[model samples]
Target: ALLGDAAHPMRPYLAQGAGMAIEDAQALAQCLSVGNAMVPEQLQAYAQARWARNARVQARAIRNGRIFHAQGAVALGRNLSMRLMGERLMDVPWLYAGGSEVHGFNGNAL
Candidate 1:
């Protein structure tokens, strides 16, 4: 199965490419460790485990690219929001949590 950039091809705005690749390896490892499943099934399981989180990260990266590259009123708003919220505005709890809720793999949440 495709993994990391091959799978998602995200921009660097979120700085998640390496992290996502590591996560992909972990999920793929977990899938391959399943005793009963065939290789095809394991690969499918890996896809199921990773797809949504990867998609979310990719989308967020795109949004961050726009935000980082904003100009005029958008840039002003972005700066104002940053000033008001500080780093809390950049907090991504779901992502930081390793998306366990979305990854019920090997009888354990990722």
Candidate 2:
């Protein structure tokens, strides 16, 4: 099965490529660890668990790339928003935290 950049190539906007690769490895390991599960079942489980998360990250990365490369009024508005709520915009607790237990993975709480 494809994993890492081969599975989900994304722009560097969010700087999450390596992190996602690591996560993919961990998830694959966990899925494979299930003793009675067939190879196809494990692969399916891994894909089902990771596809949505990877897709979301890929979409966010594309959006962030657009924002970063924006010009004119769009750039102005983005800058204004950043100035007004930079900290809130920068903080991604849901992306950096949550959802580990759902997959039976012990990821960092950060």
Candidate 3:
């Protein structure tokens, strides 16, 4: 590989990424380990929490990747819209925050 322009790797559209994987794995493993000690409702809650959140992220990542690869007006619009939207959207708490499983998906008791 030869050096060229600096590269900023595109964020994985899947969002499960490294951080998500760690969180999901830890949560899943812990939830699973509890076995019969964990109620079915809580188990369902764990799945609901992980799947819903990750699904949303994966969708957005795919969309962003498509936009990044888009041509003409579509590309311009996506970039400009993101610029106008500010960096806060880029620094999403939901994606980067490490403790999502501490309180479950909605942050209330599961």
Candidate 4:
């Protein structure tokens, strides 16, 4: 089964390539270790577990890339908004909280 970059190629803006790789490894291992599951079913489980979370990360990374590379008026407005909002603008609760259900292991390690 594919894992890490082979499964999802993420942009560098969010600096999540390595982090996602670790998560992928964990999810894959967890799936594979489950008893009574065939290899194909285990692989499918891994994919299902990671698909949405990886998509969300990829989308956020692309968006951050655009915001980071903004030019002219957009850049100016972005900077002003960031300054006004401060750290609150950078806080992503969904990302940092890291819900286990999305990982599909229910907090158990392989």
Candidate 5:
């Protein structure tokens, strides 16, 4: 399966491209380890498992770019929110922590 830039090329705003690539490799390895499925079936399963999560990450990266490039009042508000929330605002538990249910995969490796 495609990993890193081959799978989803995203902006560096979220700093997750490399991390996602690593996760993709791990997930793909796990999918391949199943051993019962054909190559095409395994790949389809990998795509199904990763599509949503990758899409979300890509979208977040784009959104973060916009937020980071914000000007005037928007920038002011963004800075204020960051200050108010501190590390909590930047901490994405769902993205970092596992437990997401992806089709064709039963592990929390992602």
Candidate 6:
């Protein structure tokens, strides 16, 4: 399974965490939809697509956490960056616009 941080996860500075996870699941589904047909090649394809993306995320998260925890100037910069993005962040429609792709057990796509 895919994994992210165990503790002190970075905020989605680029608004990617959940989206990335959804994309991962979707991509995995696309890769693994063998239609009752399983084979070594299918598994290999899924691994090929997902592993690189997962590694990129892990690397980015570590870098972001370091930036957030860096010395005074860097920490200040991080905070300032948050403030600069905060307003647009709150209003971004993807944060709330529920859709079918975010499906749930009740058939709610959100």
Highest TM-score scorer: 1
Candidate 6, 1-110: lDDT as tens digits = 34233212335644556655665567557545655436565455555555555555556656666775788888798788778897663354643443224222233332
- Which regions of candidate 6 are displaced past 4 Å? 1-17, 34-37, 73-110
lDDT computed for candidate 6: 0.53
Between candidates 1 and 3, the one scoring higher on lDDT is 1
> For model 1, how does the per-residue alpha-carbon lDDT over 40-105 read when each residue is reduced to its tens digit?
988988888888889999999999999999999999999999999999999998888874332334
Native-vs-model 3 lDDT?
Answer: 0.56
How much lDDT does each candidate structure score?
A: 0.85, 0.79, 0.56, 0.81, 0.79, 0.53
For each of the candidates, give the backbone clash count.
Answer: 0, 0, 1, 0, 0, 1
Per-prediction TM-score? 0.89, 0.87, 0.58, 0.87, 0.85, 0.48
Model 3's TM-score against the true structure: 0.58
Which model is ahead, 3 or 5, in terms of lDDT? 5
Off by over 4 Å in 5: 99-110
Q: Summarize candidate 5's per-residue lDDT along 1-110 as a digit string, tens digits.
A: 68889979989999989888877876677677676668887787777778888889899989999999999999999999999998897777878884244445444443
lDDT by residue (9-63, candidate 2, tens digit) is: 9899988898888888878887787776688977887887788888888999999
**Model 4 weakest lDDT span, ten residues long:** 99-108
What is the RMSD of candidate 6?
8.4
Query: Which residue pairs clash within candidate 2?
Result: none
**Candidate with better lDDT, 3 vs 4:** 4
Worst 10 residues of 1 by lDDT: 99-108
Looking at model 6, the pairs that clash are 102-109
Best by lDDT: 1
**Better candidate by TM-score, 1 or 3:** 1
> Best to worst by lDDT, what's the order?
1, 4, 2, 5, 3, 6
